[model samples]
Target: MLNPFSIEGEWFKGNLHLHTTGSDGKVTPQEAITSYAAHGYDFLAITDHRQVTEIDGLDHKGMLMIPGIEMDGGQTDLNGSYHMVAMGAKGPMSYDSGWSAQELIDYGNENAEFVFIAHPYWLSLTLADMIDLEGYIGLEVYNTTCHYGVGRGDSGPHWDDLLARGKRLYGFGVDDAHFGYADAWVGYTMVKAEKCEYDDIIAAMKAGNFYASNGPTISNLQCDGNKMLVECSPCWEIRVVCPLPGRGTTTYRSGHKPPFTEVEFEIREGTDPIRIECIDEVGNKAWSNPMWLSE
Candidate 1:
């Protein structure tokens, strides 16, 4: 059986995209950190717009902080503006309002340990705009701000479109918290890492050792031959999603019965990259990192 979650490590909750008074946020960086830390967030990146706010030597009470920035990649009347979140950034970002999405993503890839497109659904981006951009780890599957502010948040379809095209990318969930509009502790990533350190978190993120979630938690996931197993926090449904059409999706739901904590399914042949999703009664979901079956 190949199990990505079989490793020995603790799951740390983190938010990769957030803003502070450094940009358009309502609160100061200190307040933002305090609020998230109080809510039990293990790590955070203060990804203010076009600026990497240094948190060196600042006391976060034990919360790990990763340097990050959110860069703008021009805009159009129809698609709004393009945004990218760069984590573990080395220094301040060079902002140019004239840069295209590809150029911004390329620059982020060169300067940061982790880079991902932010809120494509909220930006009203089309497949034509995103299919050609490269050098990013992934796009936000859900952004709390977008969901709360305008009701367009889930970009899972956009992500699936990219995956269907054979583009290997991960999915992320972020708060995109400005505090004034969006609250903290809404959406976050659960990362499995060897240690609770900055470098270890970045390494795990790069290796796709994480899952995105608004609620619920995945405890175990495994695949062997034609069998698949999943154990998660009690949920109404557990689903196995494959990229192909005929491969379809295998879903286990409680319906009017008792909720389930785990499920087992027979994986169809030739399902290359498979992912798991656990949806609770309230519709909150936890998404596992995609696993390439060949690996």
Candidate 2:
């Protein structure tokens, strides 16, 4: 399926996970919304710690504001932690630490548009810890704060592992911006929606009509049978990744040659859900949602 590309609509840039002075962030709600709006963000969610941060009266500066919250509770298989980002809620929620991770996930899925795991690599979450959780939309494939503060940001492997094991999930990239470090404007989810309205944006996101990016742009992505084509900004490498090793291919930019803007690959047989990655020269990357041929 060509998905968002073939689905129709305008591309809207949004940051799903963000913090403000209402939580542990340095900036106030006004500052956070104003800054993001000024930075050309089409939409934003104020996912403060444990609360949605009340956006009704905020100026929002003509930008679409989605209600969100980030909460950590429950013990994992390794007794680690579970952090969840919940969006599209009409009100804030409170949960005791006594709740299990599954409990939080179930609640979010029931009450919100959808919820996602926040920074799986940063939390050191294992495949075992997350594989059983139901109703989660996906995990944070890239978190700006986690990368800058702890150097454990990228969660591509975590996403790959889950996909390989037959878990259908999307990926999200967010700033998780606290401003304690330079995190904002570093990561985003580009959603293709028919309008800038709140419901349309959330509906598009719920449908996975989007891609996660730190810098690179994925202008087009299409798959026909076993053959896939991706059109992106000039990048150093374009890789076709499969669940099984040796079934994928990578095209690297020739030294001193022009960067490649497009690449096509005939996927190996029976690769099921095919995924692709585009990596720019400076290490910035963009990821496509997994595509299942069977679907």
Candidate 3:
């Protein structure tokens, strides 16, 4: 089956997880919006902890503002606290620490355009803690705050484990920017949408027409039958990951004098859902959304 990248659209860079002075962030909502807009971000979500900071009246200039919130949920002791980011939320969301993971996920699914688990690796969350939760769109594969603080980011393995179990969760990379100890503009999602409008962007996100990146960018990705082709910014390695035993991953190193900007590989049968990762010499990486063979 062909990958979602074949869809035609304009790619817009956006950060879906952020905090402001409404909570514990160092900057106010206006400052956060202005900074992101000046930095050329197409869209941003000001997801304060437990409270959805209303941005409807704020002048975002040309940048699209998405209503969002971050909440703590699930069994605190067993799961180590489940943090969730809800984008395109309708109204203010109150914090309810007593809700189970599933409960919070369902609520978000019903109320928001998209919902994703945040900083799973930094929280030391296990597969068992998340595998059973339904309605969540995905997990943060890379959280810049987590990486900068405790060096625990990149939940690709955890996401792979869920994919292996037949879960169809997308992956997101975010800064989780608090603008105090954590910085912004480090990680983001490139969403392929019909336009830069709010509805279009939300639609693309819900459809998984996006890729997560810390630095490198994926220009193209195509899958035809058992063959796959990928193109990205010049990188030292391109890896194809399959969630199957014994045939887990294949890496293609760019030994060329100038490095490689593209690579192709043959897909193996039973590798139903496959994803790609491109890593540069400096260790910066980009991730493609998983492609399902049946799609």
Candidate 4:
């Protein structure tokens, strides 16, 4: 596992999924970029539905603008379409409307720097449906629009189902914002890259050198031998999650207790890869990429 915390770089905050008036969003592309840049975002992707939202020669407000598109196809178990977000693609993007999810993933991998399934929980995807699929990097563990709009945003359990079966996929939190309500800046990914340029940010992201969060900041994380160390902003709960059910533990702060900024865990050997979660008092969470012990 290549951990972002173990890498040497400045943290760059960005949202991998978002929409503008180019598709179904309420705001224009410039307005969307302005919102993120005004809020201190270092990079942004305009993932408009089925179409490339061009930022060519447009004012980006000094932010790195990545071209992106969200594709919809492939029937799910719930009789719904599969949604995949792809960014950093080269020229002449085209696809068949009847392409299967796996085919879409193959095309995405062939064209873009990276791709991921979007809102599996919202679409009712399961391990049986996704276990055999290949080429996509990961799925959205948390979506601002899905949570606040439909109460089905958190897909950590879906992610765990894959992890338990040795899938080894990454987790991402994104704001799939259409600007209908309070869904613009709620969830995002923090990438560790040497610079805010396109190559550096995309390289770090494709290498899984990042963390997903809506709130709280993870300052440091390391696993040396069987011992684990985590340093983060004040949090109400800290958890080390292993695929094995009984191997996990939770540390929490009660009423009137001081929030925890750091924690340690002595994981029993042979648990393999484990991920960390930091939850603030209000229930917003930050998720670290998995740390593998078996490697």
Compared with the true structure, the alpha-carbon lDDT of candidate 2 equals 0.86
Please report the TM-score between candidate 1 and the true structure: 0.94
Per-residue lDDT of model 1, residues 1-295, tens digit only: 2244978788999999999989999998888898899999999999999899878767886899999999996664485788899889988777786898778877888888878989988888877778877788888988889988898877877787788788888889899999886457888999999887988999888878889998888898877778788899988888787776756464533233437686787777887677888889998888887788787
Tens-place lDDT digits, model 4, residues 1-295:
5678877889999998999999999999999999999999999999988887778878999999988888888888777888998878664467775899888888888888888999999999988779999888889998999999999988988998888888878888899999999998889999999999999999888888899999989998988888788889999888888877677666742233448887877778777678899999899999988777777
Assess candidate 4 and give its lDDT: 0.87
Ranking by TM-score: 4, 2, 3, 1
lDDT of 3 by residue, 1-295 (tens): 4255788778999999998998999998999999999888999999999989989778896899999999897774454789999889877676577988888887887778878999888888888888778888888998888888788878898898898898988889899899987479988999998898999999888888899989999999988878788899998788888776755354443344435687777777877788899888898889888888776
Higher-scoring candidate on TM-score, 3 or 4 = 4
User: After best superposition, candidate 4 residue 111: deviation in angstroms?
Assistant: 1.8
After superposition, the stretches of candidate 2 with alpha carbons farther than 4 Å from their true spots are: 253-258
For each candidate, the alpha-carbon lDDT, in order, equals 0.83, 0.86, 0.85, 0.87
Colliding pairs, model 1: none
Candidate 3, after superposition: displacement of residue 17 in Å? 0.3
Tens digit per residue, CA lDDT, model 2, 1-295: 5267778799999999999998999999999999999999999999999887888888989899999889789897778879999898767788776788999988787768889999999999998998888899889999999988999888999998898988888899899999887899889999999999988999888888899999999998888877778899999888787766556777842233438797777777787777778899998999888887667
Candidate 3 TM-score over all chains jointly: 0.95
Once model 3 is optimally superposed onto the true structure by TM-score, how far is the C-alpha of residue 239 displaced, in angstroms? Answer: 0.6
Q: What lDDT would candidate 3 get against the real structure? A: 0.85
